[model samples]
Target: MTTDAADKPRAMEEEAPPGMRRVPGGAFQMGSDAHYPEERPAHRVVVDGFWMDATTVTNDQFAAFVAATGYATVAERPLDPAQYPGAQPELLVPGALVFHMTDGPVDTRDISRWWRWTPGAQWRHPHGPGSDLTGLGDHPVVHVAFEDAEAYARWAGKELPTEAEWEFAARGGLDGAEFVWGEELAPGGVHLANTWQGPFPWRNFEADGFTGTAPVASYPANGYGLHDMAGNVWQWTTDWFAARHAADPAKPCCAPQNPRGPAMEESFDPRQPQVRIPRRVVKGGSFLCAPSYCRRYRPAARHAQMVDTGMSHIGFRCIRRDPQNVQGKQKP
Candidate 1:
């Protein structure tokens, strides 16, 4: 809830930095009409005009922040035994883990085989201590948790967009368009974003012109002048995660105005039983997105994750509401 006077209005026509866009806000369908259950109950959400990042935060931007503030990511922090009871003593290493893809069909029951816990995998050394951002400075910084994103936002005098604002901006003014560009993911047989071009976790044809993370703004922009909203990486939002429409009998199905998600609960997790879990909603699919597998590229799509967990695909963008527009203010 930090605010700064330095974040005042500037020239609207001024050119935005790389991986950012100006989202002229209006009314749009926030949730999905026929996608994941959580995105159901197609709700109308009105957002005041604001500027948003055209793409997720990149490695270069994150590196600058770290250098200026000397900020350490959550993964680099020591695990507290009191918080995570029964955690193995060996697991309390001081480095972040990296997930490396292996050849073959991994066991569906144990997906952890593909995701190895590598120590010293921070933002600078994404793959491990030996790996560095190097030539991939323009690529989105991954392995960032919600708190990490928030810290970066605060340092930059920005904040994460609410779920309502995120969906409205992500739609790019198409109003219920299936994908960011159009109905077809590969229009005219051309890949638009950095997504898997082959079998899931097995092989990537690199048809989209990238096997892994692509340079930001390497693809076409959406109708609203946003880039890589469909793929590349999953962006974090400020809303707390809630169940799908089918599970919430008391939830409203119609379009909501400046809607924030349900109040934070004591506990929340997608894999756990349908109990109250306090997780945040993550929007936009990642490079791993696919029709045969994770099809969350749609604008109305959503996924949930624990606020503390950081993965290679999860990153974030920043937003700020127009000072004159109070209607879009988030509820306290």
Candidate 2:
């Protein structure tokens, strides 16, 4: 694998896709050993230059896709009994997992204490039946399943970034850095991203001035002029989730280039063989991440999300691999 992008022409020199920025690709350390075990064995990876969305897909943007296609998100479709063999019939309605802050401190280990499987909780109604995208046009769209995001990307003539691409962009040219901006979570007492300020599951100080998802680009742009690369919402990636990263080669020159993650079978949940839904890798932590609990607000942080599931904190962005298709934008 070549670590040099010296010969590869920069995407910016050519026309870039609309609403996206060119990310110059080169060799970078892909994972982290300082944080979660899943991010251990940091290894070098090389990816081709591509155009990535400056921010996550916004509510208005997804609405345009839905309006054009009249497509129904997975959360809006009724759960199939065949897919969930033992699920209760009454519980098999159209809905999604919503986050409800606990009244007081609860068991952080049990995520159910904070998450509720509420019916009628789709992308439009983020909280439940009563909630809507009232003033969230600029906020990142959530409650979108893997299929939903892929559909939008296809409709827009783009595709979801692979895990390696996402991590590379998230790093913002700062290879092996602790956080996106710098080593400190809040450098000079300023919150660079929208992460939880207080205890998890119960209290929130809103020190970042956002209790939930903030508008895209509310924070400073990264080295590549990309926004919300860290904490805002977990962005979907194309790679299937693996428990841990593959071991690096004995030689630095042998690093993998454009490496994909584990296959579908390897990404299946071992505990739930009955429901064989393969999980995808979701990059960047959400606003709910806190230091005391999930301190995964860094670029290397990743979480596994079931492809069939869509939660309030999961959303996505798109990327364009072919520079020749720069003129192709969202269809009218």
Candidate 3:
């Protein structure tokens, strides 16, 4: 595969779909060996030119989608009684998982200390019952399940980026760099993205000017001129979750082009045998990532999110593979 953008039109010079930025075709090192186990065995990958959203999809944009299609997000609809089997009726109502800071310190291994299931919680009502999108129109829409993202992408005539594609784009031509901007998480004592400032779960100094989700584009854009790729909220990708990347051939001959994830069946969590829900890859950590705990705020970092559920920290953007197909912006 070609590693030169000169082989095709330059990304910034060409016309891109509205709210999107063109990523020039290129090959780059796709993962990290030093960070998490899932990012190990860093391999080479190539992707064709594609247009990606400048930022994570925002609450106002998602609301426009909902209003146009009368689409209710997964969190807005009632849970299937058959799916839950014998759960309480109250627990079967429309709701979503929300994050709440714990008092002082607690067991970091147990996530339940900071997360709770709140009834009537959805994208609009992020906090659960009374919270609304009031001043958060610019914030990335949360509590959107994988299906919800797909719906929004479909409405916009775009699709979710593959894990390889997302990683490549998030790198912003800074191949193998630690963070999106550079080696340092916060270079020169400046916050480049909205990541957790202090300790995890219990304490957040809000040094990045945000405790929860920050509004889209609150920080500097990467080389591709895309924002919120490192933090703020986790973005969904089309690829299914795998423990690690498959081993690859040496540099001379084998660079996978547009590589995808493993089969859906392979995405099932071995740790959870009873629940059969498959997981998809979510990139770029959220505000929940902290130095003391989750350090997945980097581009190579990835997590497996259950397809059926959407938490308050998960959101997504869209991609357009065929630039010719982009017709301005969707009415919705």
Candidate 4:
């Protein structure tokens, strides 16, 4: 059978509609002074009103896009010949990798102990070759790169939210709030977001009633009526990743308006020149988030990932604006 025909999944056409919400633009504290050093010097940023997804894009939503566009994700596509000039022929297989958590601590020196280089892990098959999105129709789509996200946004007539816009919405109308809900991660001893609740890599207390990804609206919405903005999956933003602090004295005191990230670096990764490092910011934290490991759950906290590397905990949301409704000045 032809490669194109062989690659099609039987359930390709099934997907749910995308969920969206409108965010009012105003001034909000963009970074946190207490969290990661990169988020230090919290600054006030103003953003124009825009429409955003109430929740991250779910498996079903992405399945529909695949059905309509016949678009293969980076994980599904084979490595480009020109990119990897001298890569081992064996490593050129077309597939995405999966990281399965074992019951005990394994040696960190060898990544194969946890991350399996599965050849079939894609949006439809999240756990590698045999798995399918049969029951996870509502779960956020995993293993999606920035390119895949951009393709979906283009098809849907929307765009990825900028870091400022994402941070503002994540605040849920509460300026300078520590989290999406407020100061406490779980107010009144309640698990608000889908996050690691128990011992790392071993016992998952399931305090949040979820050991993995939860449904889109599994938790309460923030002040802006956005759900799953603090945890579950890290949503991709349009800004480039810069290590500089938002309030760094080296830069101006006045915050940037509708800020975009830094320019792409011309120099390539000497180790892997095949990969171009374009700057993009990822907001919110993921299920793997923990104080012991990654504490990106904070509003101002951010992380930088290559535009091409997609992981199980990384997903995205879409945005749009009417362009006619201007708003009041952003507050400081």
Query: Which of 1 and 2 is the better model by TM-score?
Result: 2
lDDT of 1 at 84: 62
Using alpha carbons, what is the TM-score of model 1?
Answer: 0.87
lDDT of 2 at 193: 94
C-alpha lDDT of all candidate models, in order:
0.75, 0.87, 0.86, 0.75
| TM agreement with the true structure for every prediction | 0.87, 0.93, 0.93, 0.84
Candidate 4 on 1-332: residue-level lDDT in tens? Answer: 00123112311432323566656656666787776766766776767766688889999899899999999999888878677678677767776667677688655445566566677788888887788888899999989998899899889988787788888888877887788888887889997888887656656778888877888889999876789998899889877777754453355555566765555663233334556666468989988786666688877888876777667788999887544533321211
- Candidate 1 ranges beyond 4 A from true positions: 1-20, 245-255, 274-277, 326-332
lDDT of 3 at 18: 92
Clashing pairs in 3: none
- lDDT by residue for model 3 over 155-221, one digit each (tens)? 9998988888898889988998899999998878999888887777888998889999998998989
lDDT of candidate 2 over 177-253, digit per residue (tens): 99999899998899999999898979999999999999999999898889999898999998887878999988978
Q: What is the lDDT of residue 298 in candidate 2?
A: 94
Residue-level lDDT for 133 in candidate 3: 92
Of the candidates shown, which would achieve the greatest lDDT relative to the real structure? 2
Q: By TM-score, how accurate is candidate 4?
A: 0.84
Candidate 3's C-alpha runs over 4 A off are 6-13, 270-274, 323-332
C-alpha root-mean-square deviation, candidate 2:
3.7
